[model samples]
Target: MVTLRLIAMAALSFLAASGAHATEVKCKGNEAMLTRYLGMFDEVFNGRKLDRIAEYTSEDFQPHDSAPGTPKGHEAIRLLVTNMAKSFPKRKLTNDLIICGGDMVVAYQTVEGINDGPLFGGIPATGKSFNFNWIDICRFKYGKVVERWGAGDALGMMTQMGFKLTPPSAEAK
Candidate 1:
């Protein structure tokens, strides 16, 4: 028992010296932060209210996983939502789970839609329907999202939309 206690003490001391700490995952539901997070989907995505982008995002917003060449700040989100809306006019975004910890909120969501309009401003509509799952980690400051990280099944959605992927030729390799 004495040896076990000494070992535990030593481990604790080592962790303290290494600055190791537990992450707090306290969910803060019904708060303004969570409210705004959900509201972004409702008002911006579902409602197609691009003007309200500033209402939900900070001026210096940064979406770490935005498409290559997408400008930072609220414009990135605007461009994203606009393209998605054009590609999937009747899309519905639903949050399956939302977790809030401190100033960060994580959302697991799904988007269901039919490709009834032009995609990426040019690709013809496939008239195909698809459902894709995605996740987002948003950091809020002053009731606005200042930073975001997200990933989704773009390849899966494309496959569902009848898009084919071709392998490179041996000569190219």
Candidate 2:
């Protein structure tokens, strides 16, 4: 019995020293709030209501993504959307699924569009179309999206656009 108690104490002390602890994120709010928030997200992103972006996003919004500039702030987000509209005028940010918890929302998105103008890194339009999947996570505060992170199927889209990942020959190089 003494040995068992000593082992348990030692283990607890080691755990405390190592600082290996798990954090549980609990939503202080309700799921309906998240649903409505996601609805607003989709509406602003897809409905071409750039002017209403202020309503859905906080003034100091921070947006992180694979986009070239890693857009941050409200105006940056607006610019990012405007640039996408230029590339694929008919592009749609279709939300396939949304999960909410702990002041955050994760959205599974299917963005379908055609490359009618420059798409990425000043690359000219290939006039091709693609459907890419994205997983976006947003942190909300006061019912506004304050921070966001998103990852999209960029490689797949580039492949569909006929972008070869092959290395050029010595002569081409």
Candidate 3:
């Protein structure tokens, strides 16, 4: 009886040690909110499946940094995606890091692509490649993104594509 008890205890200890290595512990909030937030980028943006935007965003999605008069709701994202595809046919958005607190999540992203077409209302294609960083802060409600604030290194990207900067003359000032 003493030998059998010793064997059982050793076996249980071995199983417990192995399970620790295989298990990843995440808080309940992380399991749900983080997954949904990451999915917005993974499935909608990086995946280039614009149709999935609705699944990750609310019907009244708001882009705080968009240009004046940009459309509301998912159509705005669709338009942006369409234009970007036209300019950078192989563009990709990658998330370098993401942080979540309460209902807001911030993502650090990198946008990379080769410019094989025109951009900025028909500026000629330079056939140059650009790699720049962008950041996004999203507000979620009921597991779907309702609003976002983001900015990208537009000037850096343009310079990488061979655009020159000229200072304004005194007369213009």
The root-mean-square deviation over C-alpha atoms between each candidate and the true structure, in angstroms, is 15.3, 16.2, 15.9
**For candidate 3, lDDT tens digit of each residue in 48-138?**
6888989988999998889999987999888877788788887767666777777888877767667898887888888876677898888
Residue 171 error, candidate 3, Å = 12
Locate the minimum summed-lDDT window of 10 residues in model 1: 16-25
TM-score of each: 0.78, 0.74, 0.78
- Residues 1-173 of candidate 1 have per-residue lDDT tens digits of 75675466456445533545343333656377888987887888679898999999999999898668889988898888888777788876666677888889988776666789998749999987666788889999999999999898989889878788777784477
Write model 2 residue lDDT over 38-98, tens digit each, in one string. 5666667777678888888888998876456665678866886787778888765655566
Whole-model lDDT values for every prediction: 0.79, 0.72, 0.77
For candidate 3, the lDDT comes to: 0.77
lDDT of 3 at 49: 85
Which sections of candidate 2 miss by over 4 Å? 1-29, 66-71, 168-172
Error of 1 at 132 (Å): 1.1
- Residue pairs of candidate 3 with colliding backbone atoms: none
Which stretches of candidate 3 lie above 4 Å from their native place?
1-28, 170-173
